[model samples]
Target: MNIDQLNTDYGIPGNLTFATGKGGFPMIHIDNGKAKALISVYSGQVLSFQPATETTDLMFLSEKAYYAEGKAIKGGIPICWPWFGPDPEGLNRPSHGFVRNRLWNVLETATTADGATKVILGLKDTEETRGIWPQTFELAIAITVSTTLTVELITRNLGNKSFPLTQAFHTYFQVGDINRVEVLGLENTQYLDKVDGGVEKTQLGAVAIANEVDRIYLNVTNELVINDPALNRRIRIKSSGSKSTVVWNPWVTICANMADLDDTDYQRFLCVETTNAATDIVEVPPDGEFRLEVIYSIE
Candidate 1:
């Protein structure tokens, strides 16, 4: 949608503005008292969020990330829906799903009682979507930006048959130094080591960065804390309707192969995703719904 149309349709009580961003994409810019944020109208993806009290952005976006249509931006929170990771049925369509690269319609917008900007963006099944996955559905993300950032992904099943779904909020968090960062709350959890061919393994201690690491923690439903000594702060991640978490860093070798990332880009960010992957996939029946949420705050 055009910036003028967004201003007329979604602008709220606070300072909500719209403009053409990188690659000629439409974006919503918020300057409420508590925080500042930028959200892309194309993917309904949050590009940046920085509270007024914080010294740096809580979310991270890759400097070399592509900002064009049909290309997934490499940072902030990229929603992986319907199926996470590779094509579940070996269809080889897209690695994560079609939604992240598609344009989502603005369904609603409002200013909350506490002055937070709330936006609801939606995507529905079409002939285009059915070509990838044959099902009817309504997917929407409700975002609240204030002192804290909260994102809720709502999925409503409109088809008559049940469908299996796995999803994640693939969040990229900015860090002072990846080697000096630590993640807590999964000390004893068992996880699938992706780098080791998805073998089952147990986490013996709090997560620390050093080498390439990629794991999916199973049956996890608790808050996680990323302690950044270099940054002198902690990021608290809380979620609901999610039972798994993914922690990953491509590190040196893989980062060099990725076109969207710099060779050393892995040193500045960490991914701690709230997910419904592996054995935790949800089976949604006709007219059923599922919600996956994540809230971020400073500590």
Candidate 2:
């Protein structure tokens, strides 16, 4: 729907409104008493979020990130649905499924009892979607903006046949300096090292970025903390319905090659993802539903 139609249907006075964002994509802007956020209706992606008590945004967004259709934005909490990473069937499809680049319907909007702004966006199977992956399904993402940011991805299988699914909340967080940041959690956990030929290794201590890092920590079910000394704050991530976590930073070389990211952008953001990836895939039966939720808060 157009901005006016969307506003008439789902906008919340003094809290939520529809407007055009960068590259002319429709966006939902929210400004409740406790927090502020921006959601791109084009991709159902939360592009920006900051609580009233925080000095900076909890999420990271690159200035060079593409805002055009069919291209994924470079930051915030991107929904990598259906599958994560490369095409599981090796058909050379988009690196992370088709949903991230398609438009999502605004399902609902309201103010929660806690005074947070809640917005739900959804997408269902279509002829175009079936052309890419033959599956009848419905996907919805509910975002709550309050003193903290909460995101929930819901998937329902509408087809009779069961399907295996893997996904992630590819969240990029802003940090003052990469060198001074440490990710605490998953110490001594096994992970698949994607950058080193997919070898399995155990983490030794808090994850500190000194070079290109790409690994999917396996079997994790705990809260992870990003300690940013430069920012003088800590970002806590808690998740449910996810056993895997992906930690990645493109660093210098890969950053230079990415069109949506600046060369030095690697030093400004870190990706700590909540995922159902690697061997942690889930099977969704006909008429069954699955949920992946994550909450981010600053301390």
Candidate 3:
């Protein structure tokens, strides 16, 4: 476990800690002594970040955490790279590709010019990975935490070859009430409704999830607000390098079928994903780079 400890004063309460596993993979965990994130300093797996202050959490937690062995933390923001879900072409491959489930390395860490601490987590293709997609690549994922949390994915081809992939942060947010919460900013946008089994439609008024919802909106801008009236707080989502937004809530019957997901957990969480799907497929030329960034702040 190669853990990169964040810069801190001798006894400061909460500070950041970054790590790389046996092969120098990247993962960061924060512990202010108040909210201890149960993590492995080596593997980039956020096994658990639940604070004791809250009894029930809305974080993404794997069914049974096996941090030392590098099982991708099931829930949370599993960075789906090269692909999302099952490939429509069909294969014996894993879901969302192998990035989340595999271990990554800590490439570098430094304070940013804006006074924010930036830690870059990196993962390169091994001979084993080449079997799946024979492309030499470098995926650098940087996380900066200040008043808000910013997760950035910057990919480059180091093998003198082109790389094409689909990706997302798969962010799961904790909410006070699914009913009282309404997602604003998608008023005039158009979305491909998945609940109707992949039909396209334009959204009307503010997006509300009174029932099951799954729609992937195409050509998005930089803002989304989760108006949690019950909690009297707003969860703001801002993004760059993305042209899509996927709002999903596995409501009603779907919630009960997910063994890893708590049945009634729907009441406390919502997945308003920031993505570049649909007509927004990202392609990187040989030796070229592409970046997609997403930032979330809760108030």
Top-scoring candidate (lDDT) = 2
Instruction: Write down the lDDT of every candidate, Cα atoms only.
Output: 0.91, 0.94, 0.68
List clashing residue pairs in candidate 2: none
The residue-by-residue lDDT of candidate 3 on 180-250, one tens digit each, is: 88999998888998889788889888888888998889888849998887766677788998888888888
User: Which 10-residue span in candidate 1 carries the lowest summed lDDT?
Assistant: 9-18
Q: Per-residue lDDT for 103-175 in model 1, tens only?
A: 8898888888998989899999999899889999999999999999999999999999999999999999999
Backbone collision tally, model 3: 11
lDDT of 1: 0.91
- Indicate the residue-level lDDT of 78 in model 1: 92
Q: Give the TM-score of candidate 2.
A: 0.99
Q: lDDT, candidate 2, residue 15?
A: 97
Poorest stretch of ten by lDDT in candidate 3: 4-13
Runs in model 3 lying further than 4 Å from the true structure: 2-14, 18-27, 31-71, 112-115
For residues 34-126, what per-residue lDDT tens digits would candidate 2 score against the true structure?
A: 999999998899999999988799889999989988999989988898999999999988987888997899999999998999999999999
Task: Rank the candidate models, highest TM-score first.
Answer: 2, 1, 3
What is the full ranking by lDDT, best candidate first?
A: 2, 1, 3
